[model samples]
Target: MKEAEGEVPLSGGRITPDVVRVGNTVRRPVTAASEFVTELLGHLERQGFTGAPRHLGLDDSGRDIFSYLPGRVTPRFQTWSHDQVLAAGVLLRSFHEATRGSHLAEGHPVVCHNDPGPNNVVFRDDRPTALIDFDMAAPGHPLEDLGYMAWTWCASSKPQAPPARAQAAQVRILADAYGLNASDRAALIDAMLDRQARNADWWRQHLHAPDPRVASNDQILSRIAWSLREHDHTAAHRSVFEAALR
Candidate 1:
């Protein structure tokens, strides 16, 4: 269980710090959910889902070890190409289908990623190939992850962000790629809006005392502000989004 020599510090994302690359494997600090995540990864492996990393057990330091996925992670909140948007939807659906009907689903449709933003996605050849980070994974409605994706991958409050109509179109493309049923399609917008509001509210309490898990206070502020704007943006262009879905 000894950690290999020449450990390289891997930096990205805020919550999980002290991650190091030991050869071709990643060593991350074990969290309360580490056991569940490990089992989840194992399940994905058994199901032949290569979109996730393999759980390689713990290091000598008790850090969770996983086979390092090879690909560049997309920067968060950046504009996504139409193909990328479509690929994301397809990837998400595949992931959900992999977990559907599993005991881990806990009687729900599937275990939700809960946070499948661009930053968590690994891309190769300009196409999304994998998803990383499962600390927030839990059993829930599939729309929960899709809704979060809608906000994180499409909506933005930045000056150079896409227009509301364009964002709406991208959302429609994502839904189409996922091949949502009529009922799910009708509920997509509301789910996205609800996720936005919850995200903003979740950050509001952290304004005064930011969690050590987050990257920075300013980053938190940025997220809260972005979520609020995204909510408003989606709401303002609800008609456009609905039309595109049709």
Candidate 2:
């Protein structure tokens, strides 16, 4: 994977592979979405959004080059402290606000990170400080990212996840930190459910594809089951989430 000296192979990419670090830069294989993503990054740079990596053009191999953001990414679905959750909400709001009314919105609401799970977030000093991995960035409602964040950062159904009540409290913290309005808060749970269902459907559609985004058929199956569980779990706790938002 390393084609040159001092190139350190990086891991934890859910889609793109062969990512490597050379000095203060990261090199990743450019995908079909590279042009749009680079332009979006450039826009963020012009808008002074510092949470995302700065697109630094391309490498000699035609790979996308990005400024290396230094921090630790939390393992997926790991429970976060209230502070971490709040910090994540703040960061996401800033990201969405930065793109609001911009040309990248393309007549939509704003550009969504699409996948803003903990695994894509970079933590510094034990706080969620930055976001990485923009392969799925696209124009969408801000709630799209908020819904995905609710599931991955707070409402996970994993064994280590908090109980229903505590999880609801965590969601409230996020909503408050984001300054979400009453109408949006009421719609949050439904948004989260929609995201989980879509996630499951996406995996099912790609189950047999030769896409590197998926590791194996078994892996796809597991993700499908996990997404269903998340859906059911969120549904079961709907009342609690509603009450907390009230």
Candidate 3:
């Protein structure tokens, strides 16, 4: 594999710079990666959701090209006030609504971008515009997608200190915006924990890759796991996801 010249960083997802001018990049015609991209692009085109990248075919280097959507990307933290949280929740709801029923290939399944990491989300003029980097997207449960997003975007466990009362507002706004029903809330509280445990195994392998910046992936994964297990955040979960929504 030729080394990627300069990787544009996306939070908690992997791709060697997803965007390049349509004519400049090159691609391997018959590879699995190539085929998968083609298929996904086709699917999204048919679905006609405007939030994701518009797929342009291969370029000189045989690499895939996707039109970039520009916006302010939100970093993971629990600092958002109730107002911001509500708006973000509403946006997520709208995205899912617009893109729902996009069935994945049989046996392949569908996973919404698994990394709800705040930076992976792009916000422009104070609202989330587009979601980028599908590296971790795979066959899985989307039921947890909103919960994962809520946890990652609003949890505020980053190295940087999170703002006070952010977590509470985030959870409340998300539940209200998503219109999460009784069943949804039941799953989300636990999904927050279970997802981290699952990711712990996934990150161990991810750390060995050439992206040395994520060398502590295992540690990071484990820490999330510990937090999930030890700290249920259920009180906040119920307060926001349950009471606020009702």
Instruction: Give Cα distance to truth, residue 46, candidate 2, Å.
Output: 0.9
Q: Model 3: per-residue lDDT, tens digit, 1-246?
A: 334555353333343433332233322223445555566556666766566666577656666666666666654344555565666666556545544555553343344566655566666777666666555555455555676776665664444535324464566567767687777766775666566556555555566467534546666666556555424553334445444334
Candidate 2 backbone clash number: 0
Poorest lDDT segment (10 consecutive residues) of candidate 1: 208-217
Q: Residue by residue across 1-246, what tens digits does model 2's lDDT show?
A: 546788888876767788899999999998888999999999989999999999998888999999998988765567789999999999999999899999999988899999999999989998988888998999998888999998888897877777999999999999999889989998999999999999999889987787454568898899899999999999998999889988
lDDT of 2 at 209: 88
Distance from true position, residue 15, model 1, in Å?
A: 1.6
RMSD of each: 2.5, 1.2, 5.0
Show where candidate 2 strays beyond 4 Å: 1-3, 211-213
> What clash pairs does model 3 have?
25-61, 26-61, 26-62, 26-63, 27-62, 27-63, 72-123
**Which ranges in model 3 have alpha carbons more than 4 Å from their true place?**
1-34, 74-78, 105-111, 157-166, 207-246
Report lDDT per candidate: 0.86, 0.89, 0.55
- For every model shown, what is its TM-score relative to the native structure? 0.93, 0.96, 0.69
What local lDDT score does residue 108 receive in model 1, on the 0 to 100 scale?
98
Decoy 3 TM-score against native? 0.69
TM-score of 1: 0.93
lDDT head-to-head 1 vs 2, winner: 2
What lDDT is reached at residue 13 by model 2?
A: 75
